[model samples]
Target chain A: MSDKSTLFKFDNISVTVEGKQVVNSVSLNIKRGEVHAIMGPNGSGKSSLSNALMGHPAYNITNGQAALDGVDILGMAADERSRAGLFLAFQYPLAIPGVTVANFMRTALQAHRGKDADMADFRKLFKKKMADLSIDPTFATRYLNDGFSGGEKKRIEILQLSVLDPKMAILDETDSGLDIDALKEVSKGINEYRNNNNAVLMVTHYQRLLNYVKPDFVHVMMDGRLVTSGGPELALKLEDQGYEWVEKEFGQKAEA
Target chain B: MNIVTDSKYMIPHQSPALERGPAWLREKRRASQTEFNELPLPRRGLHLWRYTDPSGFMAIPDSADETAPSENYKLVEKLELDHLKSGNLEALVTDFGGRDIKVSRSGDDVTKGLVISSLSEAANSHAELIEKHLYSLIGGSSGKFEAMNSALWNDGIFIYVPDNVEVKKPLHLLREAGVEGSIQYPRLLVVVGKNASLTIVDEYGGGSSDFRNGQSYSNAVVEIIAEQDSRLRYISLQRQASGMQSYLTHRAQAQAGASILTIPLVFGAAISKQNFGVLLDGKGADSKMYGLLFGTSRQHLDNHTLHHHRAGMTTSDIDFKVVLRDKAMSAYTGLIRIEEDAKTCEAYQENRNLLLSDSTRAQTVPELEILNEDVSCSHGATAGPIDPMQIFQLQSRGIHEADAVRMIVSGYVQSSLKLVPEDLRERISEFVAHRLEDI
Candidate 1:
């Protein structure tokens, strides 16, 4: 899930939820300067894979390894996973009352980088990032995710991505609840970040974000497994023709 | 806890310092000393000291440690006075060991006729003002220690602002203790005239942070009087020493159309028992009392507050918060009294505590006695550990657990911090934040 070097490799990583195999024997290797997207229907284990990679307690890895470069990361805690260059943009970020966004980001940036942010420097960067995401600067002092709209929360998650600049980021349904303007803005931030040779694992149920970020590799997961893998055209085809066609080919009915 | 009053611990009032004071004060001192010897010490029978243990006062130092004076008084000298040349501060009083060091800033229009002088000097020069307010809160016979302070107190400060005069800047009273084992009674008497507004900050600190090792007990009594249509902000900053066990009482009376704010920041003392009492007597009078305490190590702190609403249409709000760690313990007991005539009054009280470690603990009790049927009053209290999810959220961002705890504690206390005036809020916030870093 994370390591010193910027390489994300998941090999036969099987995950189970309450004794049921949600992510069965998933294997993928993502390196710097690459964009990978996973598009799957509900119950296809798209979110489970992301959560397992980030070491969520609900997801148990029965076998295989998720390594960053040569270092194994399955043993690390969720926080340690974050420190080791693995960032998971949650579909629903936790609302932390009484803690401001600026304070949270300051501490996060200090941890990611080895020094505290100077007041002027932090304000400048915060203002710039907020501007780039079309977020009101006043959001800096608001409680972290408390009472934030869906679009606002998604933008804040992307805001964090732009600021922390993690070596590898997993965008889990970031584009689900956003309007067109917000989707374009979030995708723009992602595109600018991938230009720095950083990697991203985009897990989505729609082909909407791929139209903006344009993943280099597309994956169609079904029955807790990737039934098909292709280039950018795969996402367009899935958008035109729903998962019913894929289920017929894979011999498994979709969950909904 | 119970202990019989020991005759051998009686203080003799015939010292040279007593001789320097006026003869009437000397006679009063001797009489109070005798009262101290006869009054029974607080036991379970006394309700005020119920939660407090009397055994802590059983053994007393053989004699009071004699103090010369404070020579290092540069804190006021280095003040950025240029920014506040014309605001308020009717008088400036600086005393070390009850001796008047120097008084200045009284020649301007705002300071004319303002009375600021040493307690001993006022006992003779301003006899009427001193005698009127002296022991007004303690009632001259509350307890053995209070009676002893009334009789043995060497020097203190007296502040009086005349009618219609508003001191814009805050008056400063600095009480610095140098000796390790000295017994000192620091007293302050304030009377704000009608239609006058004033802010007084009384800061008590050690002469040196590297205080010598020894046991000392200090009892500080403060009384304030606010006349009609006046405003007062009183702050007590007690940062004495780790070896000191202290009792501080801040009692005030608010007249009609008066507004008063009292905030006490306690960051020092091994064991401290503090009392804040306010009496709202006039219609339309308002009072806000907030206390913030941060305890580390084995410090023991007990805080009690009293709000007496004697008139209708009065309003009062109270909040007290404490953060404890490392076996430190604190208890907060508050009382709000609303009599029959106090109809239509509004009263609110809240106490919150955060325990940073398993060994530390806090107890909060909010008691109300309301005799009026048409009044609004409520109270709430909470004491618990920080949320683990909050900690994990901060930690996931790479913050150390210790820093995360500090942040949570700081945020928990900040709810009460926002209720105070703007002047001391930032300074006290920084002090609390700094204390949390190493706790």
Candidate 2:
């Protein structure tokens, strides 16, 4: 805590979606230059926590005090929070049928940076970023995530993360539905984007992604609550023994 | 609302405008004059006139007086002339209120059997060709407005592409209207000969800006014939001012083995009603129509499209899209018909409307008539607001809500815009952007 200050902090954040409490008073603090993973089973409220943090319309944050870099973001709009250095890589990215990737990126960048924020060279910068992610240059002209393969969609999300370069990045199941090679490529982009001035919080189901991008802390989310907290070894233990042990040892089992 | 009771716009038998053409052309005009006086005004609750009132398009006493051009028409003229000089366009024609037609041709291709001239001039030089094809597709019997234009049209445009001639660049026709209380009748006749190809951008710009106090009127008719094995791309761009009431009818016929592409990019006028139809007359002919319209403010827009398969083994497809915001209203009706003898024909039609605001209204009616069992026909109609999920996705990426909505609306019409030329595509995109500014 002395070496690295808190970049993102949420205190007792509860989310209610469609008249049902999904995330129950979840409290977490992510420090700069660190990576944290929240491992959980299918209906454990991991994605709900991430979505509520990003201000998804359907997921209402009933009670919470969320801040980014000591600035209150609970009352800010999604775009305001994004401009305030917060990024969320959606697990299922929506397809904008006729919007090209380059156009979308430029618009988003203009909103974050000033409208007159002159990139030294926009085309060259975009080309280099696409090359870094091993994505084809043709994808720049193609519609954003429209008709893209699963791997391609995930890679584009990381591409956004790298381009936006936010202070706190919450990747909601970024590793889901990705093959080993795609997962590696995505991990490479995420790792490249990580530095001492930023933080990463990954919501994931399996521990396979932890092997690629090592996390400093691991927490188990169950029944809309953070039941246990531990080190990276806890992820391996959860992978080996599954969430059954954590349910019996920590609290009651989650409803199916 | 009865046009027969409107005496100011009634055409006299000895009107000077109708007497300029040749003897045969004069006879046709005289017949159309009689038809115009006899035909009644379109009634409300009719098939295509349900949502729009016909009285807006009728000419008043002031509409007969000559007036000056809108201020923007000069700038637009210079821009088009620049396109001609830069080789972006094959030819440029400026028709001022359909009373004056000026033609400017460029490149060696135009000199070789590519005829672009005023209709009056062509009627004398190419009498047989003019008499045979003129008004054959759209004439007095088409509608009340058609008869009015046929009888009252002044000097107009006539384009003829000879056999085996291929014009690489687009031919631009700048139809400029006058200011408040001004009326114009614009006519266009294009014939593509056997195995030839041509592309035309018929752009309509200018009109009054005072809708309630001093409204202008414009009635237009277009007839196109794509001969055997020929190719034709006709792009109609309507971007007039807000205080204009415009009516237009466009029809084309595609011959055997020929293909026709019709694009109607409509984005202007206080009350605009346009009808576009194509007839597949010969076997194996194909026709496709892609249209886009964006309405803002309290504008009223009505559009209709038709694809008739008259011969066997023909194919046709129509995709018309509408985007409305504010208190704007739009009604789109598309019909696809396959004749009993037109076996193995394939026809498809789709009309989608996006309502950007809660007060905006949109109505889509897609009709299909298949008389033969061997044909394949399908029609779809959809009217809804923009998807909130799409907006959220854009907002999460740091795009503000308004910018996100603009981007989505622009993207919605991008597909149809792609089918046009680069210059027209850019112009249409700018129009779309301008309409979304106040939203």
lDDT of 1 by residue, B159-225 (tens): 8889898776777676765445566677888999999988887877553222235555677788899
Choose the strongest candidate by TM-score: 2
DockQ of 2: 0.81
lDDT of each residue in B1-439, candidate 2, tens digit only:
1111253356777777678788888888888888877877787767688888776666743236677888899998888888888889999999999988999877554547889999989999988889999989887778778988888888789999999999889999999888777788999999999999999999998888877667778999999999999999999999999988899999999999999999998888988999999999999999999999989899999999989999999999888999999999998888888889999999988888999989999988777778999988888888899888788889888999899999999998998989799987887888898888876
List candidate 1 segments past 4 Å from native: A1-6, A11-64, A74-80, A90-100, A116-121, A141-154, A171-196, A201-256, B1-35, B44-51, B55-62, B68-92, B98-113, B207-213, B415-430, B433-439
User: What TM-score does the first chain of candidate 2 have?
Assistant: 0.97
- In terms of DockQ, the best-performing candidate is 2
Q: In order, how many clashes per candidate?
A: 5, 0
Tens digits of lDDT, candidate 1, A3-119: 324488988989998998898898998877788999989889999899888777678899989887557889887667777878888887877766789988987888676655454
TM-score quality measure for candidate 1:
0.80
